[model samples]
Structure formats: structure tokens, C-alpha cells
Target: MLDLPSILNLSGGPVGLFIGSFLASTLLPGGSEAMLVWELQQHPDQAILLCSVATLGNTLGGLSSWLIGWWLGRRYPGRGLSNERQRLALKRVTHYGSPILLLSWLPVIGDPLCLAAGWSGVRLLPATLFIGLGKALRYGALAGAMGSLG
Candidate 1:
């Protein structure tokens, strides 16, 4: 039986990094940071390429969540809050608007932030920009730290 990292390692390098980062940004449980650090350590020269790829993949994954929320908003229109989670998400999105998506890189609330942005009818361009920026900053920071150590 192969462990998760072992299995991911078999996928190899940047391609694996992209896949891992994408999944990590989704609702699915995953950790791309380790794979990213491993990849950077192995190929420090390709740091920019790796970080760009991870950011793009992760951004797309977040967009997927946003799309789901868009659909939910369209479907329900004016549905009442079903729970505290929905209430908070709606409140935040309405109050802060698309700029709030800057926090979409956060672990627990990140995905939901994207979802709320979509559900609130936050325009796609701004949502994409903020989400991409946030994820890029995170990957950049990680790569920078790895570079300093290496």
C-alpha cells in the first residue's frame, strides 16, 4: 500500500505539483505545500515555473467552487439562510464584496469565501483577480522561504 505522498511522488514534478495544488484549493482534503516544498528543493532553478503553475491550478480549483456558488445563487434566488455557515458567508460577501476574496487563500474559510463571492453575484473578473492574487502570494511566499533556505 502506498502512502499519499508516495503516490503523489509517482506523479512527478511540476505536473504533480499542479494537480496537488488544484485539489488542495478545492473542498477536497489535500496538502500541496509539502509537494511544493519538495519540488522546489529538488528543482530550485525552476522556482518561478513551479510557483506559477501551482497558482494557476489552485486558482482554477477555487473558481470551480465559485461556479458552484453561482449556480446555487441562480437556482435559489432568495432562499433563507439554512445555517450559521450560510449566514456568515452571505454576510461577509455582502458586506465586504469581492475584495474579501483576498482571504480566499486561507485554509478553513478560503473555499467558502470563494463560494460566497459567487453566490453574492460578485463579478467574475474581480473574483478571479483576487483569488489568483491570494493564491499567488501564498505560493510565492512558500517558494521564497524555500529559496532562502537552499
Candidate 2:
């Protein structure tokens, strides 16, 4: 008879919220916005803290994807992308550079964008900055919308 929402709200807490957001920022289809909004509503005083934590967690997740691509590039050596479509994707990422990593906060293609940035050998610091900025903007926007709703 336990309500699922209530159970999640209780078990997740703040740190759990951050972890969920981190995982969601990866290739996973999960989303942390709902949990964040719920936590914000329940603990308005901690809104800023929660937002920062979520952003950091998400940024780290994006960084993980980037690192994975970088590692893969090293592992594969001269194998190249193997297809025209992949070659085009690599070309675009290489042409665009770190700024393209800002799109990493988007849904679906976001995680892949980060990975592409790495595979293209974009500078790590710049890529991280762009990814962090994008995630911060996304979390800020979601928080703003949720605040307005309540």
C-alpha cells in the first residue's frame, strides 16, 4: 500500500537526487528534472544547493562520456569511423570544436555530442567548460519553470 511517489521522495534525498541526475545525464533515458522539482518543492530553502549539486553531477556524467570516447579513440588507433555517416559526424565535431559541446545538455543527441567532442580530440578544459555551462543552464531553466509552477 505504499505510494511509489512517497517512497521515492523519501529514499532519494538530496545526494540521491544528484546521483540520479548524473545517471540521467549519461546515455541513460532516465530524467532527474521531476525529482529535482519535487525536492525543491519539499525543501525550498535548499533549492540553490540542490541545483548546484545536480549541475555538477550532470557535468561529471557528461565528462565521463567524453573520456570514454577519448579512450576509445586511443584503443582503436587508425580504424577510423568506418562509414560515411560516422565520418561526417567526426568532420562536423572536429570543425565545430568545444563550442559544440554546449549542446551536450540536450536530450537524445547530447551524450553523443560529448563523446564526439572527445573523439575529435577537442581540448578537455574547454569541453568541460561548455558541458558545465550547458548543464547549468538546463538545471537553472528547469528549476525556474518548477518554481513558477508552484
Candidate 3:
């Protein structure tokens, strides 16, 4: 059966990272951390490049999720937080404001949070800024940790 790792291998290189990061940010289940670490280890000098690409892709993916909510949310009310899991996933988003999007880098709640922000009427500019910054910071920390490994 196909999986995220296999797909990443197929799309290899910086492009793969972009793809992987994008997939990871969407509702789809994925994890770009391994690819980020592997790429950084393979070419430490390209840390900035890899991190930037991944962050950009992930941010765009988050934006896409937001847009989905912005447009379709009204049509399909509660779709963004349909069930108990999503309700729990969106707890922080409901409690906090758009800036809470800074935690958009998180795993389970991350994607739903982005969607909830748009569905809840969070503006696009702030959403993009917070999502991009959060994703970039996560990648930066990952790269830094990998750098210190060897």
C-alpha cells in the first residue's frame, strides 16, 4: 500500500520537501519531520533553503485549508469541526484568537485549527502571517536540532 514516506521518496529533493510539508499541513495525515532531518543531515549547508521551502509549502497548505473553510464553511456548516474529535481539536481555537494560529505547527489540532480560524471569520492576512511564522519556526527548530546532532 502507498504511504507518505513512499510518496516523499518518489518526489525527492527540495521539491519533495515542499510536497511533503504541504501534505503534512493539509487534512491528510503526513509528517515532514523525517524528510527535513534527512535533508539537513545530507546537506547541512542547505539548511536555510530546505527550511524555507518546507515552511513556504506548509504555510501555503495551511492557507489552502483556510480557504477551504472560508468558502465551503458556510455551505457545509460544522464541517470544519464535525465530530467530538474535531470539537476537542478546536477547543484552543475557540478559546483563543487568531494569534493562537501560532500553534498551527502542531500535529492533530494544527490543520483543524487553520480551518477553524477561517470558518470562525479570522482575517486572511493575520492567518497567513501566524501560520507562516509558526511553520517556519518549527522547521528552524528542527534544523537546529539536526545541526547539533553531529
lDDT of 2 by residue, 41-128 (tens): 8888777888888888899998988887788788896877655644655676788878877778877778777777777788789988
Best by TM-score: 1
Which pairs in model 1 have colliding backbones?
Answer: none
Cα error of candidate 2 at position 146, Å: 2.5
C-alpha root-mean-square deviation, each candidate:
4.2, 4.6, 5.1
Q: Let me know the TM-score candidate 3 reaches against the reference structure.
A: 0.84
Instruction: Compare candidates 2 and 3 on TM-score and give the better one.
Output: 3
Top candidate by lDDT? 1
Candidate 2 structure lDDT: 0.80
Off by over 4 Å in 2: 1-10, 81-89, 148-150
Top-down TM-score ranking = 1, 3, 2
lDDT of 1 by residue, 1-150 (tens): 759777556476877888888899887978788888888888888888988988998999999989988898899987854567666877898998888888888888888888888888998999999999999999899988776223
Candidate 3 lDDT trough over 10 residues, lowest sum = 80-89
Q: What is the TM-score of each candidate against the true structure?
A: 0.87, 0.83, 0.84
Provide the lDDT at 29 for model 2: 78
lDDT of 3 at 54: 92
**How does candidate 1 score on lDDT?**
0.85
- 10 residues in a row with least lDDT, candidate 1: 78-87
What is the Å distance of residue 49 in model 1 from its true position? 0.4
